[model samples]
Target: MHRHTRRTVITTLLASSFALSGAVALAPSAGAAVPTASCTVTPNASGTSVTIKGEGFTAPRNLNDGESTVPLSVDANGNFQVTRFQKNVDYTVLAVKEDQNFTFVNCKVVKAGDTSGNATGNNAKDAKRGAGDGYRAGRSAAQKSCDVKATPNKNQQHSDAYWKAWQTGADAAFNRYC
Candidate 1:
């Protein structure tokens, strides 16, 4: 074979291989659909308003029903984000599962200006990693049902039943964070 022809064929094959590798690298993986939230709360220096933003909720909600509240939005993925304003009062933000009519989780908002002392909900930092050990023992003993998974991970499968189990475990885990 001619040297130039051989070189051309080799280069073409290399380019094709590189292109295929790049395509595969950019493709989304089939097994990586678990939801996670990087939640954060930012209160203004005056404490009149607080910004709450995060991702990875079954649905985003605005527990506030008062006047002049900022609207929250969820992206294509099930993530919620909102900021609210009030006259230096604490806020309890609850993420309710609209379809299942259950509260998924609670967020406590204490604005910089808040002084009325109405804050509630567990702090995210104090939240326990697993609720099974303590939660299951108490619940199963009382209900006589051990069907629920004791330790429900944050990224577990999303379903009404799963959320119910998680809420059960969260009752105790929630207290740990606050």
Candidate 2:
């Protein structure tokens, strides 16, 4: 009876190990890929107030809010929480992977009113270009370019279609990154 009990235990352990190994196979190979990271950024009454909630901040780093970067301190237990996010801007997580030596983009930060609502779109970015320093270093340049079409052999020249396409991409990029 004792021998039978020991044999049963050993068989069960072996079978479990095989099942566990199979699960590992389902996961990406070591250093071949970065673990998919995810997070959510919540803001307080103040737009600048933010909290970052997620996992895998292996080595705590900084989070950027377009205008500046802020240091992010992760808890010893691997929990990360921040208390300030830029108002009306996009934010994202940038972290270095323990393996693969690549930065993992677990998620992007976003807020309403970051982009323009115009059919032409980019009206916000263009406004930002004029209202503040962007693209051409300030709002004036962006406004001038709103009606600008290409002049052959000159810099910043493109077709109306090109500009429209650029706006589409710009909108998508902000949505994707932020």
Model 1 stretches astray by more than 4 angstroms: 1-40, 65-71, 94-104, 110-178
Relative to the true structure, candidate 1 reaches a TM of: 0.31
Worst 10 residues of 2 by lDDT: 113-122
TM-score of 2: 0.35
Query: Candidate 2: deviation at residue 39, Å?
Result: 2.0
Q: Candidate 2 deviates by what RMSD?
A: 17.2
Clashing pairs in 2: 50-83, 50-84, 91-109, 129-138, 129-139, 130-139
lDDT of 1 at 148: 38
lDDT of 2: 0.46
Cα-based lDDT at residue 9, candidate 1: 97
TM-score of every model versus the real structure? 0.31, 0.35
Instruction: Tell me the tens digit of each residue's lDDT in model 1 across 45-88.
Output: 77666766544445555444333334356566544555566434
